[model samples]
Target chain A: MSFFIAHTVHDALTALSDGARPVAGGSDLVVGARHGKAPLPPHLVAIDRIAELREVHHTDSGVIIGALVTHHDIEMHALLTTSYAGLADGSALVGSPSTRNVGTLGGNVMNASPAMDTGSPLLVLGAEVELQSLRGTRRLGIAELWTGPGRTCAEPDELCVAVHLPAPAPNSNSAYLRLEYRRAMEIAVVGAAAAVTLAADGSISAVRVALTAVAPTIIEVVGLVGGTVADVAAAAAAAASEQATPISDQRASDRYRRHTVGVMAGRAVQAAARRAGGEMIPVPLNRAVGIGAAS
Target chain B: MAIGWWPSFSVPSGAYVKIDGDGSGQIITGAQECGTGAVMTLRQLAADEVGLRADDFELVYQDTSVAPYDMGATGSQTLFNNGRAVVAAAAQVAEQLRALAAQHLEANAADIVLADGVASVAGTPSASVTIAELAAQAAGGELLIGHGSGAPPAPPTTVGSTCVGDVGMAAWVAPQFSCHAVRVKLDRDTGVTRVLQVSAAHDSGTIINRVGAEGQVQGAVLMGIGQALTEGTTYDDQARQRNPALLEYKLQTCADAPTVDISFIEIATPDAGPRGAKGLAEAPNVATPAAISNALAQLVGHPVRRLPMTAERVWLSMQPAEPEVAG
Candidate 1:
């Protein structure tokens, strides 16, 4: 018989019920088991049947994207592309186009990987996640999403139910970049994403920069580039350089990654400035092949 | 077992180049066709000597029962070592045809020119006969077959290292050199490696088949990349490779590699054979990991010398910096 856990979610404290896991698409879980990265879970509670937990609804307050929202959904949803460009871009960059259709935002937040592509951009965009368990439900800011490598602030028995992102202003824009080894499909060596807003006079009013694959957790520079546009790149680079600590490995050195972060941050800031108020810069790869694009 | 021939010589079936009437040739050898185009190159050399095209041969190889004794398929010796054998056999056959044609045409064997499978007088056009026709007359009463054999000089006992293992071994010495360069991506957080681009420059001696030689270089590079970044066998506290399932044991994915640009330089080697060219197969693979390691050293500003640059190692490297306590 298949090792499985069956339950109906009727206001269930999702996290406590899951006891460290919530199963929707089990890509990550199954991969971890097949690789012996994590022990095989004999019991898995499938939360996908819960309609309320998988719905996307927009209201005047803000957009509440269900945790089950796939990267494919984020890339295609009109409201997400317009209001939450950073989150959409982050989701779209998770893996391949096929992975975008099956991998979920909740899984990413719960996975708690320091090199998580989506985590860094979502954090920089001021996103929040809701963790539900048997006791009740609580919302935590994306900044507090992770504690360390593969470890999050969510209690062992909590399930991340939804991702909350602030609606973008008319002058707000964002850009995401992953520095992978190859142009096709591969994991990031290091990546960086930026979100910015310009004042009425077109000077830098606010900026946010985040780096991935560079630390034990997604490193974000909260207050960045509140000055002249000419110096914003330098200021943002300095902030990221101060906060990031990379390690040398076979592929690259800590010094190279740090150097790359500065280069990437400058590039993203320039890109974000040009992209203000645009629908979204079509997740670089899958602009034409949307919703079920062949990878 | 004596053939009653002079000097106790028997019919030397020393690796005959069998040219079936259909013109398809068989190159019997013991080495696998994995990367070494020895079989094809050998066939081509035999075909050239036998007055035929290189592709008109099928190589039956990697079986000890049939192939002539080879000095193993390493050190780029496939061509100069074994190819000479087939060349000698084909040359002897060509000579036999010249002698036969000379007798039939009432001419000196030395004056007979063999071209397009026909023997004729120099500067004479009409007075020519095909070898097949000449062979037909011989086949009615007799047929001729020739033989050839050669092997590279074995290493002297003074060179090879002493064998500590059960199997007998030979000492090694460097006779060739190659250079390579690689660009890679290192994960900033987890130290994962990804190959971006590879460039190689080698002097293997003679370009027998351009595609075949490049394929060998590319295959060697692929194996080198895997050894450098992926395909590591992990051992536990008891010193065992804990991973048995192929899934956990990582292999280099096609997507994980960058396009490789290879260049082959032919250095005329005086003693290698007909034209100077030493084997470049194993040499190209040797310099790969070293080049990549040097590049990583430059990237990280430190020398991290190990088999694989795993993410765990990189993560551990990113530790709290202990200040110099007034040293």
Candidate 2:
């Protein structure tokens, strides 16, 4: 078995060319190994030490977050909190403190779990990933990048270098919400994220809604536009329920996931609209909606 | 009919207490801690009896080769049985120290008060000898060692033939009763339930150490929450267990812990235990699942009877009855 500490993106790709798996926090890969889910790859390239893959910056086109940015970083990043609040909220809800400290956006996206907290937000945000190899760099939309549960379309020799998020338009914002049996250390039984742009008339001019743990991949709802927040929210919720193709498993039954994802979608749309309208609100809308037990 | 040997009917246990020349002591027993704070409780009991600070004593436990035979640390029997042995051994050492001090102070052994490891004459404050001085002589070959073995007295021989129906009120030793009340919030949409708070009342005879007792109660209640809400083994159609990993068979996390309030009602059963204390380790866990289920049933307006009332099951229970179908 051979190991490589990639000092640059080129080195990481070179290592991957020899059947080495790229590991950036290794929270997921190492856990899989320890739990006997799978053996560790014979060769591994540690990409976390690469200085370039760890940057989050703003450009004229959009805010670019390096793939290695930890969930803890996203949860606390001031830029994500302002414009991409849904991604930040989803980041905050990822795993426990230890997992959040070591789990990275790159690993989460690459792992391609349908229940990924960041998946729905990235889907709604129209985020794209920059995959690099020795040959060159290629960009793919987040939705196009995933093929199935734990299977991504990215080639073995390609490494996800960064995530690109378009700048939130004027009077636009996003929010993500999920239902869990517990308050922490949970994969979303069903989740929803919404990015809405409000018209000057205080109505939703344009909106994108996405559901997690409700399909083979993050399911983005189409044809949700132009309505009062309540009308828009109800439409989005019902649409998501109809669009969801969840399966019954240990975490939740298909019927429950379908129904709950709809509810979460409705809540996400309303919350995103509220944020787009410039109202100060907390994430995890259950706390604000007074739905559960008072904390 | 004659009574034959009942293997576990009366558990045999032993403990050894040794006070060193420097006043520090060790209590050796075969009881296991199992993270249930048994070691701490034993230390407290031994310290109180020997008139030494709990911190001043060290415990050697769960070593079969060194320590005497115990029934092992099951059924919460460590504190109930082994604790009695510890108290007995420490008392023997205290008595010996008092006898040695009585000779030095020219007073009666019974009148030599053992307090704070100092043996003082009852009426004379100035006449005293520290446990260290007496232990120093013992360490120098004076031969002072305290040992004790404990077992319940033999039972009366059976008189009648093997009886079937309702054999006159069955004898129960160290009975513990506990009631758990919980408040839960059930999300109707997702079927997710969160335990908000748990309040427990226990009758575990006399309390040994309040802090350790509370810890036991709280930990048990948290485990109870797991049993009620999130813990289960899934099986496939072929009768194979599907989820063998920790990820799939979810246990309660710190975030799932609810506020717990515990109160103890002491009704000392002197004949049943040492210091009238009963086995509390299992009592607190027994009633929690029932209480949580009752709360969930009330919240969802349906009797949701199931282990690990997972979100899916609870949601299914909340659904309205389907329309009658024609045969």
Candidate 3:
């Protein structure tokens, strides 16, 4: 029943340590409560106003996106859109205009929905989350952070401060895409993200592929290394379909998800390879490639 | 593409128009304005008859205690039925105004023409009297007030037809007709269908308000798209309603609205509403779902036999048909 607004990261961590749940936009928490998925926590600390947590810092090794950096910010940011295009593609398709304006990267990561647009892209891009508390701070790989659907490994007293993403290598890029019924206000029925690095002779040298909403958590495709663009994309698609452990639900059946996620993985790899070959594809591969609705 | 729908019945409508001392007009009616601008369009009908601007009239409606009896805003009958009554009532006032102006101008009432707030002798504009002055004279003596209850038009008779439980639905009164042709882009891999363009042609008689009529068609087309592809009610094993929230019951957003091209047939007929106009609001809603369904059928090679044909259903329909087994 108690609510506190934290102006600093110190204050937010202190409130978290005192058993207060940290809230940024409350897009998930409030909506979930309204849908009777869960009740609101007894105490809440609003961390949206913390200035340091709202910044995006670029270091020598990688980029550090603040916990409060909204989907709107990440999708529109020039560096993120050009260099880390897959994450930008995922962020851009998060929700409608208003949802993107308020929903933050930290909140989406913490909510831990397997179908979250950002998760698969973050996994493919070698991203990690920085969880902080009054005791200390620690970083965990994005894959290790998610345990199950709507379940994360972070403790209640630890607030996710930022997400760290390694810089892309030369001649490398990534892309993400999802199967959506509508153009806006939609969750991914199934999705995939792929990162690709091309050698001098225009063959894929290193590649990573990840699938969303086809398992208990965002899962990576296995045994994909170096090959021609067509060979690697085809291999990723087959591996994703086989590795997926999807369950039937209202959005899609397991059979449909298994088939479509593979298609999406293959398309993502092709798009990523095209970007790596110096193609200036737009931020969202969905609209650029005409995946959802015709404008 | 598909064509369908007709207005099934008719209802009585009534209205009263009065000219006050200040030359402004007042209309009192039981017709309701349910965001469709049906009742608001009544002013245009009255203005055409009374030879005044639509803004010169003040409307008092949706008050049963004071206004005359109307069937309310249902069945797209507000403008169709109430417009006739409003024109009838305003015509009565027009007749009285011409008679009053003829007396002052020393001319016959038949020769007097009411236009632009002035009553003039047909070809002689100089010999005219202002309607405001005529209203002032009438306010001192005979008041200018008129009322009309337009009788409901009879339903058309149906021949060579037998009905089991006919609730008078076999016949139609001033039936509306429409055809919708839709162009869609569908992703075969994901089974997602997106309507790109819709060209709709409606024979809803004469259109009174072009903007309002086009808006109704566009809005209804969007609704039909939702019904064809996304909106559906799900029920659990106990017959309890599931997916009751907006999150599950998907409605079309503005982003999903297609480019709609609208055209009206503009047919004029006898024994119908004012200027032969028919009921319209619900007619455009009839053909869009069928149009979308037909378009999807062309893409998938077979009909998607379900309402709100979700991507999953469309994908299932596209799977190769299993070979029939010998009994």
Best by DockQ: 3
So what's the TM-score on candidate 1? Answer: 0.59
lDDT of 3 at A189: 87
Model 3 lDDT per residue over A1-295, tens place:
9999999999988898999998899899998888788999999999999989989998888899999999999999989998899999999998898999999999999999999999999999999999999889999999999999999999999999999999899999999999888878989989999999999999999999999999999999999988999999999989989999999766777888998999999999999999999999997898888774652
lDDT of 3 by residue, B112-141 (tens): 998888889998999999989999999998
Q: What order do candidates take by TM-score, descending? A: 2, 3, 1
What is candidate 2's TM-score against the reference? 0.91
How does the DockQ of candidate 2 come out? Answer: 0.60
RMSD of 1: 10.7
Q: Candidate 2: deviation at residue A285, Å?
A: 4.5
Clashes of 2: 0
Interface DockQ per candidate: 0.09, 0.60, 0.61
Best by lDDT: 3
Lowest lDDT 10-residue stretch of candidate 1 chain A: A286-295
**Model 2, range B1-327, lDDT digits (tens) per residue?**
011110112367888887888888888877777876777888888878767788878888545878866677776667777877888888898888888888889999989887787778988878988877888877776555677776663433455654532222122445567778888887777677888888888877788889989988888888888888788888888878888877778888887788999889898653455788777776666788888888887787766767887777777777787321110
DockQ of 3: 0.61
